[model samples]
Target chain A: MNLRFQATKARTSSLVLVSPALVLLGLLFFYPILLLFFTTLEGENIGNYAQVVNSGTSMQVFLNTLRIAAIVTVVDLVLAYPLAIYISRLSPAGKAIALFLVLIPLWTSQLVRTYAWMVLLGRQGPINNMLIWLGVIDAPIRLANSEFAVVAGMTHILLPYMLLPIYNSVSKIDNSLFDAARGLGAGAFSTFTRVLVPLSIQGVLAGVSLVLVLSLGVFIMPALLGGGRVPVIALLIEQQAGSFLNWAMAGTLSAILMVIVMITFLIIKFATRMFVRGRIDVAST
Target chain B: MPDLRNTSALKLESIRKTFGRVDALTSINLEVNAGEFLTILGPSGSGKTTLLRLIAGFVTPDSGRLAIFGKDMTMASAGKREIGMVFQHYALFPHLTVLENVMFPLEMRKHSRRDAADKASAALAAVRLDAFGDRYPKQLSGGQQQRVALARAVVFEPKLLLLDEPFSALDRRLRESMQREVKQLQASLNLTTIFITHDQEEALVMSDRIAVIDRGTIQQLGTPNEIYYHPRSITVAQFIGESNILEGTETPEGLRTSSGMLLRRASPSTSGRVLVRPEAIRITREPATGGATNQFKGKIASRTFVGGFTIYQVDVYGGDTLTVRCLADEGSMFEASQEVNLSIREADCRPVPQDAKDAGA
Candidate 1:
């Protein structure tokens, strides 16, 4: 009885300690979201949602957002996994330097980095000048103001998020497992594909979902690097609210994007839980 | 199964390894006979694990020739060498079931799925874990997980087996039982095995021949009885079991102890240390009136009861302390500070050379 009473007392104290943060979250985050939902429903009916979904241009924008996000996520995974593996195997000093290099771009403002990409991919830039000087092309190629440039910029920015989680998972693997696998007659590639990859899948899934979700809502990279060639949901919402002065349409689009992101998060959570439940139980021993 | 034509399972010629400035293995040359159990016994940082890793092909020696079954494997990768190893942590695949873990080697060898499952089941049955095929490794006890590892190691029938302190995590009773199980399994399969551990008792109990190692070198390699009864140097004598070492100089008659006591022995040797096993020293309250050659009058300073035997610390007349082991059921017990007579035969006093370089080499 005394133990239960002390447990309830501790719980109450913890609740009191967290109440201030809860109130701030309620006022700043939840309140704005509630107001946005109400505003979307105020001057709009259910037809607004249908119009946004059925309109060919708006539908193309949503599909383009999904396609760009998927492309960037795949490219990030392919580049980041090998880099994370390399970093995880380095000496302490080398590891520190590698991690610093991966994280340095994250410290810079995204707009600044996107603008830097603009300079690199512009006409008469170093790449085109070098290509023209090498006589590989008759004229300077158009590199900027395209979907490829936007993907390249976003991939460069979001790579560290993918790298760190995979590094964490790979480094946590016991070194002896590799030796044991080899001792059991497994070759180098067999050990990696059969043992190392499966063990680090949790981190791979996490990095993939994080990059995918973040890429879906990317604003600055498409805005600056795409040069009005790329049309995404976030850019469309900005145009609807600021340029067109259509508040209901902007609110409806924002709500749809928010719903897509939430669904992505829920799907990732469900997939991760199902994938790791058995392995985690075995690893705990 | 091991190759029958090759008499030696493994041969190490001048195997030497150095880490930074410290010599991990100074110079090691050993031959493991086919179908024999050899244990490398030592304290921590004694190069026992280093030697095992070298044999398993995980470590490349600085300068040496390693042969398995008369085939030179000095430059071979670990996967190319047909060997099985049980790690100190069991190293079971946490993502796989018990049956899948045992079938891993067979699958790697490109066996059919049905064949792999059948062999895995048979291997698990050998370790008496047949009922736990579907359970994951985390669901098993430490001992059970280790048994699963053992099954996985032997499922593919590697030429040799390496065990690196496989039972150090279990309780005493569990460790003993597992030791017996492994020994029986090894003998039944006639497998050439190399086990490494720091526990002297476990080495003596399980190994056919125990190699006592210290400071990256083998101090003595012999049977358990030879190691316990006849050690080569002071280091081996002190490491293998409890003993009383008396430093003395050789004389024309026998040995003259540093404490000014002249002890008579069968052989007259030079200045060295003598190792007297504690159990060999007979203790009595009355003075000896028999034909015993070596006798000393002492006072019991302390007594420690270790279940079956009582170890008494005796202070001799010349200020040298000696330990005497008496059985617990010896009818009478001597109290502290009681005068006692300790006697030993001349054959029981073995001479050990005092090597100054062997202290921490």
Candidate 2:
């Protein structure tokens, strides 16, 4: 009985130690989510969800969000994979410099980065002028305020998120595995495709998951670079709450996006588990 | 490349390698016969590993020629060299199963899928891991992983096999069994094998001929018996086994040790150290009657029972301690401070050069 009382006292002291952070999180984080959920149910319960799901424009916006996110994720992966590999193979000082370059844009303000892209991708920007000077284009084409602009901006902003995880994974591979592959009669290209690619799948998956989710929920990049031509779920949700003053529709859209994000997270988690199973979970003998 | 079955499997001519300011290998000239099991043995930081990498075509020699099966391959890339190597950590692909790993070399050679599977399974069976072909590398124990690595390396039957301290990570019992298994496999396949290791006993047991390396050069290269019984220098003697070297001058009768014991042996050198292995010295409470030529008196300083043999550290009257090993079952036990006599045959007292460079200097 004395031991049990001591255990209770220990538990109580630990709870007291953590209570302040717990209360802060409840007030600032979870409480807002709870209020959002209740706002979706105000005066209409299932009606708001039904209306959002049934509307053709809302459905089209949702599909557009998925398509744009998929494109951005793919573009970021293609750009990040080779760069990550190159950086991971560098010396310590070289790796530091390369990583610093990759992270500079990520550390800058997102609003500033988007606006910078606007200037660069303008009608008479350097890209169009250079194309005209090189005789590739007859005139300055529309570079900004299009689907291409949105994809380009998001890929630039979200690239470091994809590259860092893949770099970490690729760098942890043993150097001797490369030697062994070549010694076993694998040419340079064959060794890379068979050995390096298979071993670094985990990192690729991690980068894909991060870029995909972030691209789906992105709002500002599409609003500015897309010039309201590309309608996405996030942009539509923002308009519902800010311009239309329709709190119910905004809350319901947010809840649907949150559920989709959580589901995507679970699917990626399951895929990661499947890929890394029996490969990395064994004891390091 | 010519398939010269009778030619030397590997030949090195004045090979040297330097990493920036450090000479990793220097003036290495060696030849390996076909189907010969040669081991490069040394302490850590010796040039044995550098030599192996050079032969395997991983590192280019700064100056020298390397030939495998009569083909000068000094500038060849590793993949074109047709050499198979097993790393110390096995280097098995973690994402590939045992079967897939073994099939890798065959697949690289462009074998059909059915043929690769057949050969891969046969290779797995050779390593006694046929039942575990589907399991990944991480799913296997260290010894099993080593077997998988071995299977993968030899699946395509390359021109030469290089093993870089592959058994260093196993437990003692597992290491012994794996050594025997590897040796037997090499013999059966008639594979020309070059093993690199810092382990003396492992080299002695596994290699038909051993090269002892020190300070970026070969100190001595000979058969295991020759290396043990007739070390050319003090460095080789002390590195291979436990030694009690007595530095002294040569006398008409024998060598007079600096420690004041006149060891009865005709010296090969005027003044040098003579090595007497611990097992070569016999200890008894009383000297034997016949053929007790190099007998000396000493008091037992300590005794250690090491399973079948007991090692006694005897403090000789000449003020130097000589380690003596005797069969534990054959003789009476000697306690500390007990008086004893130690005898060594004249053949056992080998005159050795004092330094590694002295052998050729």
lDDT (Cα, 0-100) at B26 in candidate 2? 79
Name every residue pair that clashes in candidate 1: none
Model 1 chain A worst lDDT run, 10 consecutive residues = A276-285
How displaced is residue B276 in candidate 1, in Å?
Answer: 1.3
| lDDT assessment of candidate 2 | 0.89
DockQ of each: 0.67, 0.56
The DockQ assigned to candidate 2 is 0.56
Which tens-of-lDDT digit does each residue in B37-116 have in candidate 1?
99999999989989989988899999988888888898898877889889999998887899999999999999999999
Off by over 4 Å in 2: A1-64, A90-107, A115-150, A224-231, A252-256, A259-263, A277-285, B1-6, B354-361
Give me candidate 2's TM-score against the actual structure.
0.86
Classified by CAPRI criteria, candidate 2 counts as medium
Best-performing candidate as measured by lDDT: 2
lDDT of 2 by residue, A46-73 (tens): 8999998899999899989999999999
